[model samples]
Target: MTATRVILIRHGRTTWNASARFQGQTDVPLDDVGVGQAQRTADALYQELVGTDVRILSSDLSRAAQTARALATKLHVEVGLDERLREISAGEWEGLTRDEIVKGWGDDYDAWRRGDVELRLGGNGETRNEAAERCASAIVEAEKAMDSGTLVCVGHGGALRGAIFSLLGTPAWPWHAMEGLRNAHWAELQYTGQGWRLSRYNVN
Candidate 1:
């Protein structure tokens, strides 16, 4: 049976996040603020899921792994790492600022930013559809692996958003319709047996 609930958490903020740089698959560690945020999130999550069977899975990236570890430690559960949950690769654009990307790629970058699902990021990165498929597959696989209870997946914002849309069978283009997830915040989905339904969004 699938997991009864799923929580998709965006990793805590990083220095790059603060500076508005594209992190891509970079292994950036969490900044001090991020660490604090993770701890607070962990405490809140522990209180909420104390008696529930909760499993945590995270992207292999340092930022995501660190966030997951905080919660898993609080819950006294080991975290599982999944590469498939990593951020959408920024390729050559990793570490670049929005302005830099705009100056370099011009209209192409604008189109991608506006959510042209077919366009690969960073001139050579995975398309939104590709990222969505992989991220959604990871979540679905984790859900099927669990007999019940909640599954917490810690990952990057873009990838997490794509997973949500993908799971709901919604179009990824014009992704701006939804705002990006705040750091250390999460979205919740309930399995309705037939499909997944969003229960909460952008919750800390």
Candidate 2:
């Protein structure tokens, strides 16, 4: 049997992203530049997926949803919003920049980057593991729902990376060692009955 394929794309950069802010779970809309990036991404996918039947899925957050919408328009397909695909909740760190985080939380920011889950980013923030699990479950569920053909999931940077790593069987502890996936980048995975195998990763 042919394996099911999933194409995962990260949403275009946002104003907060340009400003180097922690935008987790924040409903920030795309700026003009981001919209342009989305259009470029859609165009790239258009050429790649020509004559292919595919479904688009996106995080319910506006940034991801907007990106998916652009791609869906290009592909002439409807976009499905899934809350499980949303960015990791950064809670109190939501709108703060890196410098601000260092000034406010000091070593906490460093610890978080170093993959320390115990060092939460203020109240209500999600651990890296929590984000990974949520992303993994969503991808698994989506694969099960699709009968055949390609599927696109547009989400945030961290969440997208987490999902891809999980699907590739990469351990959570060394996730930081993995290279960061760029804005509007695409990763592909093939799902057989036994499990998922990485076909491509961090492709722009």
Measured with C-alpha atoms, the lDDT of residue 94 in candidate 2 is 94
- Where does model 2 exceed 4 Å of error? 1-3
Can you give the TM-score per candidate against the true fold?
A: 0.97, 0.93
On lDDT, the leading prediction is: 1
| CA lDDT of every candidate | 0.91, 0.83
Candidate 2 C-alpha error for residue 15, in Å? 0.6
Query: Residue 132 CA error for candidate 2 (Å)?
Result: 1.2
Could you give me the TM-score of model 2 versus the true structure?
A: 0.93
Q: What is the lDDT of residue 44 in candidate 1?
A: 85
State the lDDT at 60 in candidate 2: 97
Q: Using alpha carbons, what is the TM-score of model 1?
A: 0.97
For candidate 1, give the lDDT: 0.91
- Best model per TM-score: 1
Candidate 1 segments exceeding 4 Å error: none
